[model samples]
Target: MDLIQRFLFEDLDVRGALVQLGPVWRQIQRNRDYPPAVRSLLGEMAAVTAIIAGNLKTPGRITFQLSGHGAVSLLVIDCSETLNLRGFAKSEGPIVGNSISELLGDGRLLLSLDVEGMQQPYQSYVPLEGETIAAVFEHYLQQSEQAPAALFLAADGDNAAGLFLQKLPAADEKDADGWRRVHGLAQTVTPGELLSLDASVLLQRLFHEETLRVFEPKPVRHDYPPDREKISATLRALGREEIESLLADHGEVVVSDDLSNHEYRFSADEARALFDTPPPNLH
Candidate 1:
């Protein structure tokens, strides 16, 4: 199953999140024929978004954006607090290589949060400081969260997985040495192990010696909502003649530019139903 597992060390003031994405990660890239390298990168971003957003207290969505001057110019992944996610990638120029620095030359990473009814979404930007996405985001957490943290991320064509460990602000001096021991263990996780192992097996293998408390898993799904209301309103205003003239060749209505690949293909009856019936919120 695609889920995120939260755990805590009983003897230390530290927390961790383990995320493994299978079907959900595959669904995001289903319609788009992204390059192999680009697909892997997007999978990594999706996993990272889940691990970080798992701790969010408010009801909202978080996005991870990567933009740069390279063959792959942009990649964006959004994950809602409910664990609904959707993303797409845009590539331009020739394909020279697939390494992080190669695909995203001089790139910047942005993490943005759009809370429900918030006047302004909170955003953070970090320069591509590491050769891999995991290293770059590790640096971001260190600077933004102001806490000592470590991460291990891996993705094959089929599955994406990551483990996050962070030391909470501790008041007791006695547990100070626990950080070093726990981080060392976390560093030993191999890419193959991360991508293949289940959450329970992986956690037991990594932290069997430590007192650990694991929580029930929460599922992650792909639920990118399309702007149907806006499209319906525009179609109604245009009337039948104008609307048919506009979509005569294309045979569909584009809700917005953001939905480059997902034009609402409404038949005559479906078109009428869209305006007559209220559309449910995107899950």
Candidate 2:
């Protein structure tokens, strides 16, 4: 089972989270058949998304999107506050380069948080400034949160994992050098260890001397249920003429939700029924 665990330094003003994904990661790629380079990049993003989603204080969803003009044109991952995830990647053609910059040439990262009761989702943009996804997120945390952070991420055919460490605003008073010491210890972790070791064992190995408080692990899963009402509303907005044209060309109007890996198909009779009543005023 995929899970995420939160931990804190008992004496120092720092917090951290660890996420390990196995079945969920495999499920995400089961239908996509992404290239090896693209798969690895998406897996890393999946891990990062889980960690961020797990920290949400309210009921909502978070989306991470990477877009550019390279071989891999777009990568998107959506994770709900409950850690339910669904994502997909789009490529222009064959992928060549392995680095983030090469795979996503001139790409920018966009993070959107849609919290409950908010009129609009809060969003932020981060430059693809690092070679690895971990580094990119670390830079984002530093810039957006105004706090130093250490992030390590890794993924393979079987699993994906991440380790995060951040300095609290009041960390300087609790332990003048706490953030430095903890960050240094975290740097010693290897990708192999992060992927294979249990959260307890890994934490002990990295910070054996620090007093730590570990929380219960929370489950994460890949769940994208069909939103029929939303899809119907979308077709209604497309207007009767467009829907009729689509049905005429293909004998049916088929709309695909890539993220959910599901399709909505409306036949001639069904499509006509949608317009039996006047469509809502989109304006």
* Winner by lDDT: 2
**Alpha carbon lDDT of residue 99, candidate 2?**
88
Tens-digit lDDT track of model 1 for 118-220: 8999998888888777888899889988997888888777899989998888713548679899899999999889888889999999999999989888898
Structure candidate 1, residue pairs in collision: none
Any runs in candidate 2 off by more than 4 Å, and if so which?
Answer: 57-59, 228-233, 266-283
- The whole-model lDDT of each prediction reads 0.81, 0.88
User: Candidate 2: RMSD over Cα atoms?
Assistant: 3.2
Q: Please give the RMSD to the true structure for each candidate, in Å.
A: 4.1, 3.2
Best by TM-score: 2
User: Least accurate stretch of 10 residues (summed lDDT) in model 2?
Assistant: 274-283
Candidate 2, residues 1-283, lDDT tens digits: the string is 4999999997898999999999998888876778888988888999988998897667689999988888989889999888899888898787898888888889899999998889999998888888878888888888978888889898888899999998998899999999999999999999899889998999999999999999999999987777876788888889999998898889988888988777888888988788886655755
